[model samples]
Target: MATYDLKGKRALITGGASGIGLGAVQAFLRCGASVAVNDLADDRLTAVVDELASAGHAVVAAPGDVGNPEQAPAMVAQAIAALGGLDYLVNNAGTPGTARPIATDDFERQDEDFWQLLVNVNLVGPHRCTRAAAEALRATGGAIVNTTSIAAFRGGGSSAVYCATKAGLVSLTREWARALAPQVRVNAIAPGLVDSDWMCRFDGQDDAVRMGQPVPLGRTGTPTDYGEAILFLAAGAAYVTGQTLNVDGGLTT
Candidate 1:
């Protein structure tokens, strides 16, 4: 058996109905892991699970708003129950708030509601979910892979709050790695300008051409791009922890 073998391992992914999260779910299933997906859209969740089941993979649907404090724990519990035990946790749920240049005073003036929503979903939500699953993760000696973004480092992706929240997640990854050493590993991936619905919303482009222009790679990243990096961090990077892998196709450069 391969040392990176995920066969029979159980994994949980937040925001797994679409985009990078869905890509991660597919990758994990391909590696023989039973996957549990959590997302906000009920119909999308049901449809995704149905597709996976038809493909002969075990999948659990756990739909809810991860940003809600109570809901994160409930989803974790549901996944644990369905999978029998947890071996991996992918904190992939995130949202870009109103995108604007940092120099604009309007961007700086983030009202309480805007700040709260961005921070809760991008940062605190993962914190809550990981905390809830810590025991199960430790018991299985599993790993956690968070989906952070280059905005965390370079700034100016979406709203100011969104950048701050992603930066905070990088901090959380290191914090958890240190605190949970030897029992569970914690890491994150900071992608730069991935091609997703969020990008479509941000750029008003229905296709990849407009989205890929600015990047040095001459293209925006696909979900499969980050998906591959994430699975490597989870299954193959056993000696790795407290690290943030950049899957941005050198966009930051």
Candidate 2:
């Protein structure tokens, strides 16, 4: 794992209670950054904060629904206030809205309400947080790293709606990079085959083996696999912006 001297830095991670978000949380905290873990108001959110706090890490719970327009910016503001200021924002909050992958032609499942929900959290949610945090980040010369997905680059993911939102995020990453340039850096990561809680399953006896067989690396990826990448983009990679790093284990190759 990559390491950095983040003793006085502060960060905010949305959808941070589990999976890649949790991975980033542990990475930032391990490197000495104070973090505000954002998620929906629920027991899982409280449990994560309590666990991290008990471990002596500087973590506070910033619970709200990223899918809710009013709650999104409000949560970012609260997180910034609690952490004193923000040096980094990881827009990792998103949902596939379904456990199973929806076919490209499944327009019924990809209805108006479904698209709106995905767009709200996966696309518009980051915009809300970035808009709220732009000034703070600019003051500190900080950066924003969005948790996009390999779905944005390829034909497979949870659903067409999910892919559309993630792809839109990639466009936003570049646009925001230009908009926030010379001040706050903007970038993204497109993870592939990560064995996170977001929903990857197989009925095979060895799901990991079954799922990872097609990848050149021959294994599924874990949260830690992405945590390292997040660490680099957040605290290192000073000159890199507007790019989406593929953190897959050679899956796309």
Candidate 3:
């Protein structure tokens, strides 16, 4: 894992109970930063918090559903409070909007409710969290890293709605970077075929293995790969903003 001089900084990572979000939390902690983790309120969230705390990492639980507009701001505020302030915000929470991939021709499956869910969670959710954290971030000249996906550019994801939402996030990242200029730097990471619990729901272990065969890296990405890129945006990429770093191991190249 890569290291950085993140000591004394404070961060909040949404959907941080596992996968890339949890990996970000661990990365920040390893670099001596205090991190507040946000996820849906549940036993899993509690377990993650306890486990990290037991290992002597500076982590706190800020649980709420980002899909809920009302809950999003509250969750951000709670995380900011827990961390005393916020220097970095990782908007990693999102959903595929289905248990299985919905092909582009599956128009019947793309109902109003499905579109609403994907938009609310993947698009509006990040906006809500960023808006809520803007003031705190401005105060500290902080940074924001959004988790988009290769689907944003390459297309073909778990659902058409999922791809659309991530593409919207790419646009939002550029716009937000402009909006928060000179104080809070905003950027995004586009991950590809990450091996995680979330992706496993759509692509089984065997599927992931097969998918990795043609990649330049000869393997699927890991949460730590994303974590390192996220940390770079937050702590090391001083002149970088409004850009989408494709952490796909040359898959997009």
Candidate 4:
């Protein structure tokens, strides 16, 4: 719930239609930033934009499937156009590629197609969005905050492929920080068990209650928790980059 004096700042958040993405959008708006939210082109996108706009927020829609290479560039371009320029890009779009966790021993379930889908959406998608937005980000001396996961380090995600893709993203965050240095900053967030639709897929309401008991914080994460971390990385962490902030309520510890 922290606020910043970001009246003129502009941001584009991929997967901004819901969950952490939506939370970031609201946080940026609360701090007086004009935000462009990106999600797969669908009715949900329209609904979210409308809902936020109705609430008097400076929000615009920039819809496209980040997983589609052919569509990623256009998505970033449209977002930049909508915002006039980009100051921050939150690469938050990702997928688990399954309805539930797939155990490592279930070799048959870890098929090539599952691997391909997860890689395309969770790994390559961020690269595509970042590449497309690099010039504008450099122009504005902006920052990039990628949405990684605790799975990257703990290897306890829905699938091995899911963990691998997040791990790849962590590597990319460092490399991109180096590549985009002296102009733009790049960092990442590794969330633990967030109470979002995505997490519900792995742990339903009942299980989530039981899961929270083990966390040091005694509760699951919320979208606002992630949004605040992202806002810090984007608008306040002037001297920070190439690092992954674990907003996991000490679960990883």
Clashing pairs in 1: none
lDDT of 4 by residue, 41-156 (tens): 89999999999999998999998999999899998999899889999999999988876766655667688998999999999999999999999999999999999998899886
lDDT by residue (12-127, candidate 1, tens digit) is 99999999999899889888999999999578899999999998998989887889988889989999999999999999998765652333235747789988898889988998
As a TM-score, model 3 comes out at 0.97
Write down the TM-score for model 1. Answer: 0.93
TM-score per candidate, in order? Answer: 0.93, 0.96, 0.97, 0.97
In model 2, what lDDT does residue 163 have? 89
* Regions more than 4 Å wrong, model 3: none
Q: Each prediction's Cα lDDT score?
A: 0.86, 0.89, 0.91, 0.91
Candidate 1 wrong stretches, greater than 4 Å: 1-4, 98-105, 206-208
List of clashing residue pairs for candidate 4: none
Could you report the Cα RMSD, in angstroms, for every candidate shown? Answer: 2.5, 1.4, 1.2, 1.2
Runs in model 2 lying further than 4 Å from the true structure: 200-205
C-alpha-based local distance difference test score of model 1: 0.86
Q: Candidate 4, TM-score vs. the true structure?
A: 0.97
Flag the better candidate by TM-score, 2 or 4. Answer: 4
Model 3 lDDT per residue over 190-252, tens place = 998788865665557888777777789899889888998899898999999999999988889
